[model samples]
Target: MPAFPRHVSRKNEYRILSAMLLLLHLAVWWDFGSSKSRSLLLAHAGVFLIWQPFWRLEKRFGLKDTVLFSLVSIGLACWIFFCWFVVLIGLMSGFPGYRRSGRLVYMPILFFLVSDLLIGCVPHIFHVKALPPAVTTMFQYGLLAVPAWVFIVRPHPGGGASLYSVDLLRAISASMMTGMLAVASIAITYHLGVDYPVALFQSLLGLALFLFIISWLLSPRMGFIGLAQLWERSLMNIGTPFEQWLAELAKLADQQQSPEQFFEVSFN
Candidate 1:
């Protein structure tokens, strides 16, 4: 079977690392006071930290049937950091039986119903604005939900025709961690008297860099098939020399050799 080569040159690796560091430095000095600049920086870092790694992992593992990992990664990162409601909607829609005939059609309707109730009716009961801040946020996330279904519902790429549970779990776990850290950082910064925009930008950039480092360290040292072969050779089979010794012992046993002969054969 053909596989994408895992051969990345040292020079290329160094270049990528250097560029990332440069971007980090530039982001550090960017005017975080401006909402536009902060958003732009977050988007850039999201592409680098989430999109790039996800694409590489998808290619390396051959995990998905569609070319939508990029969209999935972007949507997931945005939802984790900015939109909790979208994640809830995804979890609600991603269960195993939801993909059955007649059910898939209703998932979106259910999502919209719940969203509208939360954004419209609940606020009406509270006598708040008809369109509150939370509703606007949910509306924004509802747009993001379109791309997320591709990630949650796609079949596995390899022979196993199921969802890529490992990849999905990893992504979700990392997203949750990133979200928690970002919130903690922002809260701590707020307590320390840092401005909201700067605190947010700094916290997000720090979380991205931390995730990058963790992924770099935890990435496989060898190709998946190569690692499998290594495991088979080192674990399943003893060695050529041991196989030869076993062959000799079998010969001795077949020949009706005496105990003395078996001992000689075993020692030699």
Candidate 2:
């Protein structure tokens, strides 16, 4: 149970905090902009930077580092695309190393990324009209409340980064896979002559079914070994030696006189 230095009793407050800020930003700033919108976006980036995983806030930054940070954060906000913004933020969550980051952190991060791409990005690709202001407003601000209820009721004592260790391969894979799923769904429907909103719905339904099947394969509820467990066991518990052990057990049985004696000697 590794813990972040900032919070030895780390509750993963930063992970959720950054995620919320990202969502809040996207709720309003859905398109590329300049001036006031860009300013607001920079402000949002500031909040995330405080808890960003790429570098430690506890350490001092030099002039070069400061400039680089400003350029990336400000540049991203100034040319902001809601879909891309959330995707990048969600991608950064993988920096803490997936193997080390617990389900609490990883699950929410995945939810944030996948949801943004599907709900916010997919239709935009096909130039669909925006949702009505009222519906958009409701969703942008309040949609996350429902899912947040399923996560983090209490501040558990562990499960945040102890140190920043970016797993580059993992970070790319998670983002690309999630993005690809969304794109592939839309691509399939579009090629089949499906229209915008309907295409969106159908694509989502197909994606959901795919995800359900994958989840079941990883860990089925039926009385049998799951693929995840079976893979792990294969790596750790190779069964070839069991054959030799069985042979030795049989040889020991013949060395004893009666069944009772064999049983006693073998047991010992």
Candidate 3:
């Protein structure tokens, strides 16, 4: 009946959730031991604060629209810098107001593919030292699951269940599939052997390129479809004169005496 949950007041909920997120980010920064990882966690935190449903500090503090927008934009940029794939999974998982698919059964399959083809698989491809099995597992699932829980599981102020039971099942399935793939890839690569930094450079470089291309394709303004269309048009000979010729051809086809004549005129 109430717009917001009567059980927990909005301000209290925001404070509690924000505190939990801050603690979790710090724990991750301590555990991951990477500057980029810490930056990524900060970005996720930024998105969480400005994400509307999860928190209301913006409205409570009387923040301007431009300020809020800037926060969200910066958060997004940080995610892009850290791992574009995680950003994609967050988008695919859900947001506060938008409706997504009923079942993302294929998401797990996609995760394994991306990890194999783009992430962990690269190290193996180049015979890199690769992370320890435990570390690799953490990177594969723990790293990704945190963001999924935040963006996909956490409910907004007025929003209902972030995911149905079935949706949770799909996320679980994806995680399991990724775990299996990581194990298999590591086993195969371990037997083949690595050449230290030589392989590391190769893997990291290839992965960087892969992420860049994927990020460009996923861009809202100029995605792969836009790029493809531009490429096609560039190679096409169509111009004003070509358009006029096509119009005249259509006119001649309309005036044809029969279907056969129409075909002949169009071909000519």
Candidate 4:
């Protein structure tokens, strides 16, 4: 198949992913039997038919998948959603499709999965109050806002999916850091003797300091190599490591029969 531009290829995937996310968010938020929740559930199932990665993109579903999809859809349409549905969601997410997508593409999905577990499921097991309105608003609206900005406002390169690529290390550390901060603040409030709000304030202050440290590390200006430079070295052509250059040269060597041809191909 001919290669299409990144934006062209990924645009539909983005829409499909966004639809699934929006439905899941609404299903988790709305009350049972509300908004003809049965219809909402059915629509959610239909979107997943396209979003699922079980089969080839253009291939028709086999008998087994057809039966399973129909049965699951009927069952879900009968008002079987919320925490239990989220468990099903968490399981379905393990289908190895989105997990293999780009880090930027999957991070939002991961966050929502965590949200369903934390906000939707945990309360059923433990006594928990509704999230602060500000927090809830941020999660709800922030999801919509980011996608809109990406799709409508931000200009994506034909060669790249986003303005910049996210490294796996930074993504992993950011997720871990968020969880640690939340846990530490709560622990401080409960065990270390302080008000919850007070603990939160302290965490915010620490976060600001952390941001300053990160800023400095990005462009330290201290003769030492900055972290950002090291991170970006893998991307830009000029400063890629010698091992990568050697590997590319080897590939070019194999492809071209003559030294003159090899030099010509390498220069291109």
lDDT for model 3 comes to: 0.45
Best by TM-score: 2
User: For model 1, how many clashes?
Assistant: 0
Give TM-scores for every candidate, taking all chains together and pairing residue i with residue i. Answer: 0.27, 0.54, 0.28, 0.42
Candidates ranked by lDDT: 2, 4, 3, 1
Q: Which stretches of model 2 miss by more than 4 angstroms?
A: 1-34, 73-113, 121-126, 131-135, 144-154, 158-174, 185-193, 212-268
lDDT of 4 by residue, 128-147 (tens): 34456687567656656534
Q: List candidate 4 stretches off by more than 4 Å.
A: 1-11, 32-35, 62-64, 77-101, 124-128, 146-268
Each model's lDDT comes to 0.42, 0.57, 0.45, 0.55
Question: Native-vs-model 1 lDDT?
Answer: 0.42
Query: Residue 26 error for model 1, in Å?
Result: 36
- Candidate 1: tens digits of C-alpha lDDT, residues 1-268: 1233323321133233233323322332233224543454355454343223224422543345334545554444322324433343333343334235224432553444344333422332333333445645556455344334422443322311122132354335544654464455447554776644456457667778987765555456633555545545655565656787788888877775588777776676
| lDDT winner, 2 or 3 | 2
lDDT of 2 by residue, 26-132 (tens): 54446635455456556666555555555554556678877887787656632245455545644655555445335555565566555554555545545554445
